[model samples]
Target chain A: MTYCVGIRTNEATIMISDSRTSAGVDNISSYSKMWRYGIPGERQFVICSAGNLATTQAVIAAIERDIKNTAETSLLTVADMHQAAEYIGKVSVAVQEKAGGGAVFEATFLLAGEILGSLSGLYMIYAQGNYIASSRQVPYLQIGEIKYGKPILDRVIQESTTIDRAIVCGLISMDATLKSNLTVGPPIELYILQHGSLTLGRYRSFGEDDEYMRDLRKLWNKAMESAVDAMPRLTLS
Target chain B: MTYCVGIRTNEATIMISDSRTSAGVDNISSYSKMWRYGIPGERQFVICSAGNLATTQAVIAAIERDIKNTAETSLLTVADMHQAAEYIGKVSVAVQEKAGGGAVFEATFLLAGEILGSLSGLYMIYAQGNYIASSRQVPYLQIGEIKYGKPILDRVIQESTTIDRAIVCGLISMDATLKSNLTVGPPIELYILQHGSLTLGRYRSFGEDDEYMRDLRKLWNKAMESAVDAMPRLTLS
Candidate 1:
């Protein structure tokens, strides 16, 4: 299981994903699920995957392979974010059909990025190759073990949230997920892409022992504890 | 999809459940998932159901029939809390087999109660007729759409947590679930049973327009929003 969340705010689009994968309790492994594709200052796409590792890896490999082949419908050939998402979706669907047969080779993704001129956005790609972008009413999309971390995003994130605050909210949401579930764990990888700051190195990975991650976890836990403590005390009538 | 949470504390045990049941997105209706079976003051058990609505109703009907029949095993005939849990589990399995041959008549339960002289505890019964009790390390058990509401419970509930606070935590957990999930919603039924207060009428249902429910929802959303605001702002190094 993986937990990946993408927050699209007015200033920036942020995507965060946990790095833990386990076929079972005994076969636990760590795999980075973040992939960036683009030409610097022209276009950028950050993809966070969750589901079958083999399928996700295959999709990633296929996307990379497409970039190397001009004939293929690569991200570079796509004119807009929608086409980029559709291309990834098509690649993902074709890869699963060839590798998984009738079995479930499910891999969902959160794609967030911007072209040179169009609106910056976030899209959640389904295992079935369909996708939906974030709207004004809902400015975030989450994949994988999403439920554990969703309440915080539902409450705190908005279209007007600042990039710094969006990053913080995404980190808090990821922290909540990592604490409650083993399938999703650190190091958490985050890509913060503002609409125009298309520099190639706008990504960071917070390892298990990273100072900021530790402090944020402790801080957020205390904050949530206090929130519950301050709830109205119910009295028997 | 239902969301039922039961928290057992040193002083009191409480159970809260949503009232929504659906065959699909198009067909949905409200059905109370809470039931109580016991002699007042002498013994009482609160049962919260999640999963197939038909199977849950069937199990409830069977338990009621057993209570009326002195020959068969029933909640009344059970000697200890374990026997009571096992009896309910067995009845659940039998009822599911009868109604849903191979079509997955799954219904999970949270059973919390006490006998006249035995311990007051909580048990989570699986569809396979097996059950596990809550421990000091884990003082709460949730069924149905549990993940959305789990982080708050994981961070707040403890063995020493006050019954009032546990009730608050349960409410917050249920509220989070109801907000993020469609399968779980109001009217929310809650039961607060203390170690010694084996009283009837402790059960209350907060309807969609309940004032307190509205206030708590507003309060919790504000609390979470404030928490996100208070996070240490991240500065790119």
Candidate 2:
């Protein structure tokens, strides 16, 4: 299991992913779920994956191999974000089929970034290989253990939200998921791509003992406590 | 679909259930999901149900019939909270079996209350006619569209939490579910049973336009905004 989110605001695109992956309760390992692709200043893509680690790795490997070989439909060859999504979806489906096609080998992804002149966008690719873009109304897409982290996104994310706020919201969302679910753990990866930059804007990783992560958690916990305390008290008879 | 949660605190038991029932997006109606039974002052039970509406209705009807008929193992005759849970589970499985025992006709329940000379407890009864009690460490059980509403419970609920705080948390939890999922909606039914009272302490139903519900939502939204704003900001390059 994993948790990842991709948010496209007016100013930039933000992608966050937790590294923890669990085959079962006892067999847990850390694997980076976010992959960056494309040539700097030409195109940029961040793919955050969930579901079977094997399938995601295979699909990602296929993407890298295609890019290395300049395959006919590789990320470097795709004309737009839509084509990029389609190419990734095709690779994902082919990988799953090669793995014998079942629930165990399924994977999902959130693809976010710009294709040269195209506007920055976010899309969630399904296990079936179909995908849907995040709209101006929602402005975010999440994969894996999504529900625990969704309410905050639904409450705060909008097209007009600032890049810094979106980053904070994404981190808090990931933190909420990590708190409620054991399957999603630390060593979190976050990437930012300023709109039209055609380059990775900022990248940071937070390990379990990282100072910034600790401070963020403390601040968020305090905020939640204050929020809970401020709500109207129930008057029981 | 529905959202129901039962929380047992040191001072009381709190059960909250949304009243929305929908077979499809086009077909929606409201029905009370919380049912109170038992002899007040001697024994009391509150059953908050989710899943197949028909199966829940039948199970509730059967429980009422058994009590009215003075059957051997009715709620009135159950010796303890565990027996009450077993009785309800048995009834639920029987109802599902009568409906042909498939996912379509399955229902789950949260049974919370006290029997004379016993401590208050909360149990989550599954469709398979088995149940598990809420633990001191968790102090809560949720059924149906649970994840969206769970982080708050996981954060604040404790064995020593006061009844009023528990009720407020339960309402906020239900409100979160409502905000995130269309399948679960208002009006909301909340039931409170003070520990050792052996009676329903208070009951309130908030309709779609209820003043208190509106105020709570407003307050919570404001709290969330402030929380989001107060979180440490990211310094992106």
Candidate 3:
């Protein structure tokens, strides 16, 4: 299981993903799920994957190969973010089909990035090769074990949210997921594309014991406890 | 789909459940999931249902029939809380089997109650006739549409938690689930059994527009928003 979320705010786009991947309880391992691709200052795409490790790796390799070969319809050559997403979807489908039939070969992805003059975009590509872009009413997309982390995003994220707030909200959402589920654990990887900056604006990874991670957890916990205290009591009449 | 949770604290035990039932998105209706049974002042149990609605109704009817017929293993005749749970599990399995074989006939339950002299118990009965009791380390059991409501329960409820806190936490948890999922909705039913009373301490049902429910949602959302503001900034260096 995995948890990756992409938040598109008016000022920036952010994507965050957990690193833990487990085939089973005993087969747990840490693998970064975020793959960065682009030519600096020209275009940038951050692809976050959740599903069979082999399938995601194959899909990423295929994308890298396309870029390297200067394929007619690669991420670098796509006209806009939609086409880039569609190309990834095509690569994903081809890879899964070649791997043969089974849910085991299934994978999903969140693609977030920008091209020089086009509007920044965030999209979720499904295992079936279809994709959907985020809308102004709900400016986020998630893939993987998403439920535990979703309430915060539902409450706090929207088109008008600031980039910094979006980044923090994404982190808190991931923290809620990691706390409630063992399948998703640290280190967490995040990519930020600040408005107007063509290339990735900031990227950071935090391990389980990282100071910032610790502080975030502590602060969030305290705030939740206080929130609970502040809630209206269940009065029975 | 349904969402129900049982929390056992030192002073009392509480069960909360959403009322939404749906065969599909278009077929949605309200039906209480919490069923209370016991001889007041002697014994009491609250069973919360999830999964096939037909199967749950059948199971409840069977329990009622057994009690009315003075069956040797009925809830009124069970020797202890564990036996009562086992009785419910047996009844559930029997009900599912009688409805013929299909996933649609399977049901799960959270049973919370206490006998005259036994310690209060919280049990989760699986569809397979097996049940597990909640432990002091984790004194809550949830069934159906559980993930969206889990983080708050994980963060707040414990054996040492006050009953009021547990009740509020359970309500907030339900609210979170209802907010993130369309399949789980109001009116929410809650039952409370305070320690040694051997009778229900309180029972309340809140509709979507219920004033208390409205206030709870308003306060919780405000708290969460403030929490996001109090979180540490994601300082990039």
Candidate 4:
């Protein structure tokens, strides 16, 4: 299991992913779920993967292969984010098809980035190879184990949210997911792409012992404790 | 779909259940998911239901029929809380079995209460007619749309948590679930039974416009906004 989220604010596009992949309770391993590909200052794409590890790995491998092969319709050559989504979706479906159907080989992705001239956008590419973009009204899309991390996003994210605040919300959202499920863990990968900046932007990874992660947890816990203590006492009226 | 959670603090057993029921998106309605059966001062039980509404309704109906009939094995006559769970679990499986096998008629329950001579306890009765008690380590069980509401419980609940705090956490947990899913909503029912008291302690229902609910949401949202703001800023180190 995995958890990933892509939030597109007016200021930037932030993508967050947890690295822990578990085949079962006893066999857990860390694998980076976020992949970035592009020619700097030209266009950039960050793909976050979830679901069957092999399937996601295969789809990602196929994407990297296309870029290396200089295929006619790779991420590098795709005209727009929509075309990139279509190409990735087709690759995902083809990979799953080649695996042959027996058990579930499904994978899901949240694709976020921009073309040279267009604005940054977020798309969720489904296991079925279809995709949908985030609108201004709903400026985020999440894949994999989404629910535990979703309420915070629903509460805090909006069109006008600043880039720093949006990234903080994304990190907290990932924290909630990690706290609730052992299958999802760190070091969490977070990528931020500011509006109009086609470069990779700031990329950070948070491991278990990382100071920022620990400090954020402490601060949130203190906030929760204070919030719980200060609420109007229930009178049972 | 519904969201129900039961938390057993040393001070009290708190149960919260949303009122939404739906066969499909267009056919959603409100239904009370919490039911109480007791001999007042002698013993008490609160059964929170999830899954097939008809099956839960039938199981409750059958239990009520038995109590009214003054049967030898009614909830009023069950020797202990475990017997009560067994009785309810058997009834649930029987109700589902009676509905035939082509479709799913399963229901799950969280049973919490105390008998006159025993300590207060919490039990989660499975649809297959089995049950397990909440321990000091776990202290809570949730059913239905559980993930969105689970992180708060995991973060805030403990053996020493106060009844007021538990109830607040439960309300906030339900709020998160409600915010994330349309299938779960108001008015939410909350029941708290204190230890050694074979009677319902506090019972409250929160509707869409309930003032306390509104205030709590406001307070929590403010808390989250501030928590986000106060956290250590990302340095991308």
Candidate 5:
């Protein structure tokens, strides 16, 4: 299981992913789920993936191989962010064709970034190679173990949301997913793309023992207790 | 869809369930998911249901109808909490047999109570009639839309946890579920059982204006934001 979120804000785009992967409780490993493409300052794109690690890595590797061997169909050579997303979908389809083999494998990606003077859009691409762009009402998309972390995003995220708020929302959302799911663990990857800048900036990870996460856990617990205690009691007949 | 949770502590047991049931997002209705039985002083039991509401209600109705006709197979006549769970499982099977019609209708029940001088216990009964008792390490069980609210329970709940703490944990867990899932909605039912009390105590429902829940939502959002702000930045390479 994995948890990855990408948000498009008025000022920037934020992408976050967890590094933990597990086949079962006993077998756990860490793997980076975020990928970067394009030349810095010219055109920048970021893709965060979730679902089957093998499938996602294959998709990314296929896209990278295309970029290395052929420029016509590569993300870096795409005309705009839309074309970049199309390039990703095409690569995903190619990977799926080779690896699917009549069996079902679920892999999805959240693509967000700018292409210099062009658009910065966020698209959620499915295993079928189809994608949907985020809209004003739904400015963010989450993949893998998404239910646990969806409430915060549903309540707070919007098109006009600030980069700082979006980052906080993304983190809290991941925090909820991590607490509930054993498969999603620490060392979270976060990336911020300032609107129109095209280049990725402010990429980081929050690991276990990070003071902010500790405090968030403590405070969330305490606040929950206080909230339940303060709710009015319902009397039965 | 529904959300129900049961927690056992050294001093008491807590059970909570939501009233909303939905076949899909557009089709939703209110249905009670809690059932109680047994004599108040000698022995008492509470059962919370989550899954197909029709199946659960049929199971509860079957139990009540049997108790009305004969004490020999009644919940009130069960010798111990384990026996009571078996009785509930049997009733669930009967319901399934009557309405199942070769199709799978999944329903789960969380049974907890004490009988006179006997010990108190908590058990989770599945659709197939098999059950598992709660242990010290895992002191609670939740069914239906459980992921959103499971984080708080995973972090704060324990077998030796206080009744107040457990109650709060249950409420927060329910809150998270409610926030994330429209299928699990308002009018939450909560029940408490003190160890050796042999009776269910403190049953209540929280509506939209429920103050404590409102405060919890507010405080939790604030706490999450504060926690995110306090997170340390990763030094770049």
Candidate 6:
């Protein structure tokens, strides 16, 4: 299980992914789920994956292989953000082809970034080589163990949101998920892409001792308790 | 999709269920997922259903039919909470039998209550007629679209928790679910059973305009935003 979120805001785009991957309780391990592509000042894109570890890793590797081979449809060579999303979906489908089918090779990606002179977009790519771009009304997309952390995003995330606030919301959402689900753990990778910059900025990983996350967990618990205490009780006759 | 939760505290047991039932997004209707059985003061149990509405309602109807026939193993005639859980499970299995086995008939129940002189307990009954009682480590159980609302319960609930706090937590949990999911909607039905008392102490349903729930939504959002704002920033360079 995993939890990854990407938000396209008015100012910038924010992406976060938890590192924990677990096939079962005893088989839990940490693996990086965030990938970045393109030259620094030319064209930048971030890909965050969730689902089967082998499948997602294979999908990423296939994309990287395409880039190295100078394929016409590679993440780095794509003309725009939409093309980049298509590249991701194509790669995911290719990976699924290699895995002998039993259960569906479940994998999804949250792709966000910009091309130098083209549009910036946020897309959720499915395993079947299809994608949906985020809209003004739905400014964010999440994949993997999403429900545990979704309320925060549903209430606060908006098209007009700032990048910093979006990042904070993303982190808090992951924190809430981690608290409820042991499958989504720490060492979270986050990527920030400023609108129109064509460059990824502020890429970082939050580990167990990360002060912000510690404060997030503590303060969220306190606030929940306070909110519950403040609610007026119902008196039934 | 549905959402129902049952919490057993030292003071009382809390059960809440949403009134929304849907075959798909288009075919949705209001149906109470909660049902009460047993004599008022002798042995009382509250059951909240989640999953395939038709199957769950069928299970409930079967139980009611058994009670009318003076079956010794019926919920109304069960000796204790464990027996009551078994009775529900048996009914669930009977419902599955009537489905003729295509896809497994999906339904689950959160059974919580007490018998006079016997212990209070909360059990989760599966569609297969197997049940597991909640313990100290896991003092509450949720069925249906549980993930969206689970964080609050994970962070706050305990076996020795007060009924007042449990009730508040239960509502907040349901509120979180309602915010994130369209399938689980108001009005919300809540039941409170005091420990050692075989009768229900409180039962209420909050409609959309219910003043307390409205205020709860406002304050909860405010507190959550404030908590997010108060989290320390990541200062890594």
Model 5 chain B: ten consecutive residues of lowest lDDT = B228-237
The fnat of each candidate, in order, is 0.80, 0.66, 0.79, 0.72, 0.32, 0.67
- lDDT at B25, model 4: 90
Model 6, span A1-237: residue lDDT tens: 899999899988889999998888999899999998868778888889988788999988888888899887787677888888888887788788789743557798999888888988999998788999999998999999898888888877889876666788898789888888889988999888888776556788989898777877787677767667776776766
Model 3 misplaced stretches (Cα beyond 4 Å): none
TM-score of every candidate's chain A: 0.94, 0.96, 0.97, 0.96, 0.91, 0.94
Per-residue lDDT value at A11 in model 1: 81
Off by over 4 Å in 6: A100-103, A209-211, B102-104
Q: Is the docking of candidate 2 incorrect, acceptable, medium or high quality?
A: medium
What lDDT tens digits, residue by residue, belong to model 5 across residues B100-197? 44445778899988899789998999887889998889899888778877877776787877677677778878887888777888888888887877
**Which has the better DockQ: candidate 3, or candidate 6?**
3
lDDT of 6 at B205: 92
- List each candidate's DockQ score: 0.71, 0.64, 0.78, 0.71, 0.36, 0.62
Per-residue accuracy of model 5 over A1-237 as CA lDDT, tens digit each? 899998887888889999998888888999999987768788878899887777888888888887889866788678887888777877777777777543356788999877777778889998777889999888888888898888667666778876776777788788878887788888888888887665557777778787766776676566545544554443443
Better of 3 and 5 by lDDT: 3
Chain B TM-score, candidate 5? 0.93
Instruction: Enumerate residue pairs that collide in model 5.
Output: A230-B212, A231-B212
Per-residue alpha-carbon lDDT of model 4 for B32-72, expressed as tens digits? 99998777789988999999999999999999999999988
- lDDT (Cα, tens digit) per residue for candidate 3, span B31-70: 9998998788889889999999999999999999999999
Predicted complex 3: CAPRI docking category: medium
Clashing residue pairs in candidate 6, if any? Answer: none
> Interface RMSD of the predictions, in order shown?
1.5, 1.6, 1.2, 1.4, 4.4, 1.9
Worst lDDT window (10 residues) for model 6 chain B? B228-237
Q: Local error of candidate 5 at B45, Å?
A: 1.4
Error of 4 at B75 (Å): 1.2
